[model samples]
Target: MVVTATRTALASADVLADVSVVDAETLARSGAVSLADVLVHLPGVEMTRNGGPLGTTNLYLRGGNTNHTVVMIDGIRIDTQSGSGGATCQAIPVGQIERIEILRGPAAAVYGSDAVAGVVQVFTKGGQDGFTPSVGVGVGSQGTRTLTAGVRGAEAGWRYALALGRETSEGYNIQPAAYPDRDGYERNTASLRLGKDLAPGHRLDATWVYSDADAGYDSTTSKSSANYAKDNRALQRLSALGLSWQAKWSDVWSTRVMVTRADDRYATLPAPGAVPSYNTQTQVDTVLLHNRWNWREAVWTAALESRQDRLSNAGTQPRDTSRTQDALALGYGAKSGAHSWQVNARLDDDSEFGQYTTGALAYGWAFAPSWRLTASVGTAFRAPTLYQRFSEYGFAGLEPEKARNREIGLKYSQQGHEFAVVAYQNRVSNLITFSGAGACASSFGCYANTARAKLQGVTLSGATHMAGVVWTASLDVQDPVDVATGKRLARRAQRLLKLGAETGWQTWGLKADLLLSGDRYDRVTDARPLLPGYGVLNLSATKALTPNWSLLLRMDNVGDKYYETARGYATAGRTAFVGLTWTGR
Candidate 1:
């Protein structure tokens, strides 16, 4: 089942949207500590990181800007109103996640704002019928170590789950030209979920997650002075809490009320003993009331949402600023025989930017057995972040970014075989960019709505299981361009290809993955030359030692390929990890 695409639960095979789902089993086998690394394996998804695992990271979906995507953890919206306004991917822990869903294209029609690109929903571990306890320890290359423990259970109409994890790594020098020093990184994570069944048709739930991390990097703007090198470290923390009530009044009527809060804190340590700089804190609070009516072959949904974003920065001019948005949304879905359709509409009122409305329509036709064709059209928008409007380089008159999208897809699924081909075109107006210093209080630059973008792409993917082996492949060809400059978007490759195979031999299970990409430019201004294309391979194996124990061995970048996702940043390079896991029998 999938719910992110339409804001309601439904069979994934019949949904008219382009979406992907990932389970816990696949995540564990990948051995990826960073959410950015795992998301890159999905079709048309790409990411760039500055230095180590806990470094500043950004994810681009279908060629959209990093801030265009919306992220949620268990029902809580998690985003930062500072630093260009986007979700902090490095703060999420892979060890605590149970499932993930990716919804492609504009989703502002279903969700209110900041859904101009897509949406990523993460579900953490939850309680089962009985107590289940687990523990794991792992060691990897580069002086890396990890420890994790979790427990979940249900008893007497009460359910609870808890998870804790820690990871540390001795990273490599990202910029040997200026600062030849080893960068280090460390992180701690925790998650909790509690629930109670009040009656046959009512329930209550509470969820929370916290992450704290520190990472080292090098900063050198000039080579004229070797003393300019500084061992900079980034300090970051994120926490989210969600509470909800779900009631099924009858077979045809259901309702949910939820409230959530998220906090993000960030700072910089110029040196080992220097005082932290650029300290900032961002807080978001949200409330939602949702109603659904399920009757025969049709479903209807309505939602009322309210959100508040506040930012406190010791470095910015204003020091403190805030904004609010309230929205109402309506949706409908129905299926008759082999035909299905979905419609959504939303209206938003912002305290600073006034009002806006968006809508979407999607249709699907099952013309033959195990085959479906889909088409969709939608519109979306994103409000400017508080930092972009009240900081030293801010412009209070900047308009919200807007977008329109159209797409079509064909899919076939049966048994253990699945295939899909999708094509889409999205255009964005009032795109924000940093321009000359004349319009703002700062002499360096100011944020302005002086750009436009065009993102068009085609993606092909397939998977099949045969002879105890599973094969998966996907290819993406895209054109992401700046309409004003006619140059391609920075760090986005025009072509990407990925392949994977999994099988079992006796008690051992094995897997392999390969990724390839085309050449890309480092900046939209063409200030630097084009970066060359690259490929990397990864392999892993798992074995069951006993009824309650398992062993895992994984190797990444098996070829030791030297590549850079960003111009001055460093990749993880070749690394190996081995782990032992234990579970209560």
Candidate 2:
């Protein structure tokens, strides 16, 4: 397996830094079978799921808001809808990913808005020399089954690829219920990529992708009702179209321009006696231009971007709004001897939230052949979403969330062994909250600055390869507190752990993984006990049956661990499945 962590002018292999790269092979071995499943097992990461196969899986990284984590595909932001702030990582299917590159720590200096937590970049697979056809089928616990197929190839001066996948499963309890779990889901997704060599020094690439999903949600947990079989339904649909052109104009300068558009529709229908269903349709369009220049030992990167969004909501309360934003960033970095230094600044002007500036500065020094030290300090800000700013019984003066962070880390890598640890603190102000979303009579105030939070944490992750086997582990310790009340914040755990190993022997493969999460208070002010510590185990094996085909098998949550990350939700139990894969050149 090979990890593609970063892509720069000088892209190198075997990088030693604060990062985690998941290769295609490793993804399959985990038996995660879903985007959210893969991330939950990573350190410092937690997920919230409504209940079902394609449920609303929201990710919280390093104690940051769900919208503070950026999702990118091939270096381009794929998230849409300013109201949602950020797209759900779980919306993307794993079958189309070639590799996943995760950059940890503050990245607002590079990306923007959502980089407060970090960045997850997904790169889709491309074509080889000849057409390759592949298919896979898996059946596991809870009446689960998945089927996927795809073809890839290169012809003429253009390379083209396509993939289609479908997945379904009868999900788990989600919460203690009066009846057996009655949640399940179905999804259909397809993606296409085409690249053309326009000139000796220029190229063009285009991608079109679409997904439609019908998923069930166990909405009973929200109410005190013991009738858990009452599951709502969610319909999610997304379509994206993008085009990019890259050209090398000279030895010292190069440029790339991209235009992208996305249409997203989300709807939730009540089950039986629930409130009337609601639906939201959002459209996002963006254009970005990036240019880089290298002058001797120093390099500069600058980008200009603009985005426009409009959303329409239908149901009990109808509303609509449109906003536009323009942003620009400039970064300078240089390498001298064994030290590297970087500085970046960015400015964003939003139609609804005024303007804000964010930036970062960092230094990396190599004192020894195999040891390096990095230190960074940065300031970042997130504009209040339209919903947070102007929803319902309005609070017109709400401020954007803001934070300042500082960190220092060390890295060491020799032979195939590597390790890194970073300690960081982020002081946040004006953290936005919807506590005021509670229904209010016409004469009462509905929104106000009700709370504030502080997040301090240390993250440690490492990987080692020895005797033809690779081992990896990560741990996160976080203390999230409500500064207003001097108490611990809600839904923030104190400890998180993950460990995994993979080995291959003469045409056979073996892998195992473990995930453990500690307990936390369910409410900040009330201090109610919620979830407890729990562990889950996953195992997989694969064997080559022929020159062009292989057989694979997996068991997920093998321990049948019963626990809830969310206050009232229960997770899935043990499940098993098998698949077949074929590759070609």
lDDT of 2 by residue, 259-366 (tens): 988777888877777656768776778788888888987878898988777667641133776778788989787788888877888898878788878888878898
- Against the unseen true structure, what C-alpha lDDT does each candidate score? 0.90, 0.73
Task: Identify the runs in model 1 with alpha carbons over 4 angstroms from their true place.
Answer: 221-227, 272-276, 527-529
TM-score of each: 0.98, 0.93
277-356 per-residue lDDT for model 1 (tens digits): 67889999999999999977799999999999999986566788889999999999999989999999999999999999
Superposed by TM-score, candidate 2 places the C-alpha of residue 401 at a distance from the truth, in angstroms, of 1.0
**Worst ten in a row by lDDT for model 1:** 220-229
Best by TM-score: 1
Q: Which segments of model 2 are wrong by more than 4 Å?
A: 1-17, 80-84, 222-229, 315-318, 437-449
